[model samples]
Target: MLAFGCTWLYDGAMSRSDRFEIFLAAPPGLEEVLTDEAREMGFGPVTAVPGGAGLTGQWTDVWRANLELRGAGRVLARIGSFRALHLAQLDKRARKFDWAAYLRPDVPLRIEATCRKSKIYHAGAATERIARAITETLGAPIAEDATLRLMARIEDDLVTFSLDTSGEPLHRRGYKEAVGKAPMRETLGALFLRQCGYDGAEPVLDPMCGSGTFVIEAAEIAVGLPPGRARRFAFEDLAGFDAEAWQAMQTPRPPRDTPLRFYGSDRDAGAVRMAGANAARAGVAALTKFTCQSVSALTRPEGAPGLVMVNPPYGARIGNRKLLFGLYAALGEVLRREMRGWRVGLVTSDGGLARATGLPFLPPGPPVAHGGLKVTLWRTGPL
Candidate 1:
């Protein structure tokens, strides 16, 4: 809920000498989008890894990442890594590890562990060993409901420890309390926007705006707002956190604006109303418009050609998925007839639903997980 001045944060950026590994998580298929965003936000040198991007920076960098990056699901600070052949070795190394470097002795920590191709194959036991180390040596208590979580990952006998700096996933944004079934995660929506080549200069229209995530995100992008500006992060509880420095880093900037407006249309009237309310909560209401209307009734507003991104129902769970193809085709017919010159980004778990749209789409992006379904972003050039 606070901000820092650009100067103060950048100074911290240059001031840190002890750089730790910072990993920014993204949806599986959208790692590249997060990588691009990380570089654009000045986190470098960044390497695009399998699940996210890896970079090295000081604790200040860790806080800034949790504050600024819109595309990352979570920001993890890789505290340290070591080799451990078994549980006793892990316990010995963990006991010696400098937990004070990141965790505060007074703060409770929740530990999560994962093991793969490692001699210490029991992840739960590994977690308990690390938890005991922190408790017995560092004096921090283990708690089931702790706000701060430490992740212990043992892969191929290498025990790597990381702190979940972002607390709740970044996409929660602490503002969107109103979401319909299959609500697109704000982080996922932001990545999809990037994949669609939206730089926030263009107007965006989400035809099936269940909770208006796409429209709100587009407006936020256009206005240069920090997605985490309204939320608290786990990093605030770490030993390295500086309240003054962080506040300075979060210094408020004048809200940026664009002349172009983003729009969303949904047939569910209550959803339309909720989206509008959510937009106001996010401080993007002035630049965004939500309406209760069917896709068949969608019309292009008076403006330059932009992008029309949609996340329509594909019946992945309960409904007759076959019938949804006709809906896709109808929505495509609407865009094809009404929205010439505007690019399209459609999210659906079913490729057939995408193909049914009949819009001239390029190959889809990689499959991304959404509400237990694997979906991809299908794109098109200016239609």
Candidate 2:
């Protein structure tokens, strides 16, 4: 599921009064970046944990995080936690837990459980117990494909329960139905924009635009659009999901009136057309221009220098590694000669490919796992 700040229907509705612990899951090495975004978005007392970021907020914050946060893969609302050493203790505690606080008796449910270094190592057994407890106490049915998931993790004898409030990853952004080979996820694209100092005040250009992920994301950020606005969320099915309040919360903000148009170009005409369609669906076509052009023919747009970012094809996913060097070299040469005062953010899986750019990029960032390949962002100051 995905969304944006534009108006959409409140299909799922409920009501709740619990103070939920919202966990915004980020990529493995980008926890700090996600945390900074949460803090910048006015989330209170946020904490960056090992695999994700943690914070305390109301149900509205949970909805806002899913709607507004571009960097979070998915948001998990932690309902409660306790210490249970064995299966009997787990069953006893599960029975006493207040399932009605969050879940509705009519909606179907799904349970996912994990155990690590704990006495109760049987994940399936734990799921069964929890399912039984919910069925007996609250009356929600269990289904394998239910969108509302109750996730339980037992570690060091501590049982933690969380609900998958964001049904699908936020990177979907409810637009961009068409994608090119090895397209960059929108969540990662948002962080890469941040890493390269993109503040939505300047124009952004992506020569190897693919389906125009970078350009569209830049336009959305500039206009204050939330990533979840165009789609419904799983949270709407839970108890206490005020539909009218959420609709009010997701109303579009006044867009910043910047004449600077974001630009994206691809050698494939089909990719360029797909990008244009996606930009239109995202409500930013007026502020973006996608063209069918190759990197060799790319010229600086008619405006002040802005961000020049690209997520090129990786060797593992596409063509041979050797042929890409010339492509990278040509890309580097074009930018260095024409786009003065422009910043660059290049995402690549191979260090050799990045060096081929020769763009005066500083040391690359920590390796991030994407599409099963370790990738990193190579950045450059004004060139």
All candidates' TM-scores? 0.93, 0.94
Poorest lDDT segment (10 consecutive residues) of candidate 1: 1-10
Taken over the whole model, the C-alpha lDDT of each candidate is 0.85, 0.86
Question: What residue runs in model 1 are displaced by over 4 Å at the alpha carbon?
Answer: 1-16
- Regions of candidate 2 where Cα sits further than 4 Å from its true position: 1-18
lDDT of 2 at 350: 92
Return the lDDT, model 1, position 328: 88
Q: Write the per-residue lDDT of candidate 1 for residues 1-383, one digit (tens) a residue.
A: 00111111111112235666778888777777899999999989887887888887888788888888889888887666678999999998888887776778999999999998999999889988989998999899899899899988787787777788888889999889898877889999999999999998999999999999999999999999889999999989987678999999899788875898999999999999899999999999999988888899989889799999998888875368988878988999999999999999998888988999899989778998888889988999999
